[model samples]
Target: MHSSPRIRTSVAATVLALAVVAPTAAMAMPTAPKAPVEAKKSTQNYKGLPSGVSKKKTLVIGLDGAAAAQINEKNTPNLAALVKNGMLAKSNLYANPMAPTVSGAGWSTIATGVWPDKHKVPDNSFANPNYAQYPDYLTRLEIARAQSSTLVVGTWSPIPQKVFGEKTDLRLAGGNDAGTTAKTVDYLKNGNPDSTFVHLDEIDGAGHSSGSSSAAYAKAHATADAQIGQILAAVDERKAKKSEDWMVVITADHGHTPGGGHGGSSTGERATFVIAQGKGIEAGSVRHDVKISDIAPTVLKHQGVRIEDEWQLDGQAAGTIKADDFDSLRPHLKTGVDETKPGTTTTGWTTTAPSGWSIDNSAMPAGGVTEWQGWSFATDEFWTNVDLNQGRETSVHNRNVFAVADSDEWDDKAHAAGQFDSTLISPSYKVRGGKTATLSFASNYRIDGPQSGEVFVSFDGGEPRLLKSYDKNFNGVETISIDVPKKAKKAKVSFRYTGTNSAFWTVDQVSLKK
Candidate 1:
């Protein structure tokens, strides 16, 4: 139904990670409503598919790590079959840019239909050692899916498992034998969940390990395809006997590069397809643009959840695309691009200005200097000396920007523009006389509301140059640039300092290209 993937140098490049946090007392116990498994036994061979509410059931098969490169009609006939009978395309699901593209963030967003910060399920580590937890919005649905209403089955990480444990009866646990398929079967025959989410992990794991095209990767695809066939068998069994408007959506959580990594900069890293089919949906539907964030929102709409206001997402209800609603979250691109690898690592070249600038992790003792081009702030706390803040003020600058992001941790301040700025601070960039370059950096400003940030440039000590500006009133536009004439080569671009410095933008890919 969607795809996800990212940056940086040896400095660990500020990964949007899931940090460990103890679960609250409420999360320690499971949230599913206790009921005998026998009560669901009498249902037909349909998961999330009730007897009469054909339109009530929605199934999302999350093909984690599946990308555009691995998809083929011949390789995945089962998915192709669904598309042939229904409509499917790319979709956006998350509103925040740093919603960690990994399994934890993407799946949690899918299950909850809310931003990672809102759901509070960052990754596996939060709940488990390997995975994280940030809380989840899918707890009740997991119950609904197990009852006569919905069923969720897939290869999921411990991240989601911790937030909504034992909520569904047909859960097949990810990383197990026939994990994705077994749960689909359980729902089809025993639970009949009205809304089901099926997932596959091997493909993504293989892609992360060996790229998406390696032999191991190919085998994973073929195997997952075979599994899709099995799932289709179960879904088709009901479609054949009844005039039901069953729908099947097949898509990947995120894509991978050719060398076993994703994120950062590359179209290949963002490239994944969506294929859908069923009643009330169009067949042979081909869409050109869809972000991975749109999948869960679409599914939730199909399930009759008022997702519009509950979730602050960038995705749209793609279910009606066949009916011609094309205005949805277009796409949010990676700020940096690495010309070498399939995934984005670095974009341009950058260095600290007025050399010998103080490089300290005072703000985040654990986190190093988070310098960027324009913005550097924190949310609830500043990393002034490696200490957390509930929103503190600290400032130091030598014409650099900085930021810190907990990708899967989609909490409050994480969505604003700056967790660091208290007042207007300006950054400065200068170009020699014959240089034309670009300045790009990864920042978690969290300024989705009314706020503004500006970029200032200087040339030969002349007047200042303002490359671009951001405010609570910032409009939607990717790859913004303010071209400096050749005479402006002596000009530089960066953010000026004013005040409010709780975080730093870990600067990278700062380049002055020809």
Candidate 2:
């Protein structure tokens, strides 16, 4: 687990005390539920503007510290309506090293379309932010389309003062949540803004004052939900008068611990969500691949701004995201076995590989943790819950179900065999002879003790050649160019991991393109 710097304040101390006294209910994991039915794709031609609508605009509402699991039709009718009409995506955040699950890092990642490692705002102090390189989405819109108007209204001063750039048309700092909502509502109803962002901080304050499981937290959500309803009403009134298309996005920066406070690796603290309704989005869809970083790109894409490759953004547009082969295994993922930290009832971790892919554990460990004995497919929720604060939470880039080789968890149980040795083999792909092919995959490799992660490529069923070796920490997508043999017609890729009471390696979205 990543370490958080001490917050020097009386409130911080009080929150810490509350955390110890009232542990979150999530600490007691529930029995594994049945696999969820796959979401159906919309068949409607959800492209281009609707009839009579000429311009495309967007509104992003940031509800600080609101947990997705807590929202429902009873408590948050307005937000629940949006979820029924659009899409709700549950996601997690990083802790410590990458950045604490605090407002500074969370909001920055949402605005900049990148993680804290790139934005450099780890804590609330906002020391040395790299907005010059990765500016907020609204700032990027101004640079890309100067004629477009942008507005940012927030209760949190740092958001409008530091996170967003000065190029935005209007930046307002509301003294409180009511003030922020008033300013935003006025703009949406009266002003002709192309893109707008509103941040509400009352919910987070409520969480800090009272535990997330407390009635005060629920009341805070109700208050914010009413405020959001006002904002949505303004949008509707504007849409009724003008022939315009509006996209609304509601999201949270981070979640509070059950007993309040954050900046830790607990499941509740790491929780974040995205609820979006707009053109091209499937109604009532639930997805797990969306990240907080995706908010910026999603807004940019909705407003018809061309995302430049030079920007090096880490997020893809939410509506445009297509599920990878590994993501398709969600419905097939099995409940936990031989692991009891979060209980053996969690519905994650599957040793079954997708069609055309295979896992080889012949070299073999005999009696390790059943779930992680080999390359296993898993969701972030299950894998991170196994052991908190071990840096698994930092794998924020990989979304949905990804392949993991966790010897650390596997070694928890007594084993009758040698060290963990497993290989994940990819299906063969056709390649042009003498041409360079790119092998792209998202990889997060952490080393502890003695461990090795190697990537190999074989051409035309010939001897495999070493493509890359991982001996240190790596945490992003890797694109390697491989020169095909003069007479080679096909290629297959493989990821082999070996460890002895060491850390782990996770790989996902593997593809080979010429």
Candidate 3:
């Protein structure tokens, strides 16, 4: 598990200084801004079978220890070609307590469609895995569709022996990357498999022998690319003869450090990516929200499998993923003014609300970090890179841009006065009189020092009523039901946070339903 950094004197001094400032009267509620015209939703299709395809098939390729940032056209031409024809999505992995950025935890998450907290594969030892409760997707598919054929070949023995299940039609352990690629190519060319998974390990071996920055690592990429090219050729030949639709997805388990090691929370070690090309998937598109766990569900989706809600899978199909209003702020994000760790060029953390939302900083202090003076919308890359190894990596459930109230990062710079306090107001929603409405949102709250997060609701301009108050660590989607009083027509929700050099609170994918 990662440990918190020691609190600096500047923050402690600021806390003492703020203790003397007298409290002022409450300010009036600010007027909500006009909602912008809703942009036309993209016509890009991510579901259903393509026009000519009668049969659906899936192929998943795993490249061990390959970081998304290191892949380029020069070294990995075939993988780059897949990106050119498909979608390239970058995502990070959890570290330490959740699971170290190791192959055991990473591959388990991809195979089971859940996080380490559920799968219980905390390290390479593979102790007390919850596979019986949450089996590999292939095994689940076998149970759902008895007639479908499945195959799995892995260069790493543990993957085939322990990760995949006994129910798979065929599971083989190839001694090395070349052997694994050859087996996969032979099967695609001669066999009639409905779904296949292949794991290549030479790239990871190279990283372990020579650092990721070494020439040997680059050579490994070239070799792996060639192997992937051969596999793609086999797939093309099979497609031409069988007249089938194939959705191919390529991804990595975890990334490597510059010096060739992993199992840490550094940006390099935690980095992972997804590249997919096939029916219903947009061509030449890029995404920042897809995660490693998405591969299992995406494969099941392409193969016409119904995902049950009771499974409690942590991933959604890549094609079916949609962006929320907060994600639309990506282009408008600004470079950091006080956060020097992520550098001055990173465009992230904007205080400007998306459309109908507003941030109330009327009770906030004079100076903190400009990026986090109030509730700000930010991307994962920008926020997590500020300081590594802080539980921020566990914010895996949140996608794209989300709301953040970070007193920890804000205290990194010199502030004039006061503790961190901000409120995020939501757009007014239509509510039925005398009926119950549910407010649902994904929240991740981490507390280091003193901090409090409270939720309030007001109806028809009535006084705000408390719904929930958080003073401890909480993570997951929260659903709170509110009884609408008689004759109520409209309701507005608010989130207020107060902290003194504590951790952070992130909110995303908020909605209200009756």
What are the TM-scores, per candidate, against the unseen true structure?
Answer: 0.52, 0.89, 0.87
Give one digit per residue, the lDDT tens place, for model 3 in 124-218: 77767888777888777766665567778887766776787765666776666777788788877776677888888777877776767888888
Model 3 misplaced regions, further than 4 Å: 1-54, 239-242
C-alpha local distance difference test of each model: 0.45, 0.82, 0.79
Q: What local lDDT does model 1 show for residue 216?
A: 78
- Backbone clashes in model 2: 3
Ranking 1 against 3 by TM-score, winner = 3
Better of 2 and 3 by TM-score: 2
**Residue lDDT tens for model 1, 456-495:** 6556556666666544322121243455656754544444
lDDT at 365 for candidate 2? 68
Q: How does candidate 1 score on lDDT?
A: 0.45
- Sorted on lDDT, best first, the list reads 2, 3, 1
Q: Choose the strongest candidate by lDDT.
A: 2
Candidate 3 overall lDDT versus native: 0.79
> Alpha-carbon error at 450 in model 2, in Å?
0.4
- Model 2 / residue 266 / CA error / Å: 0.7
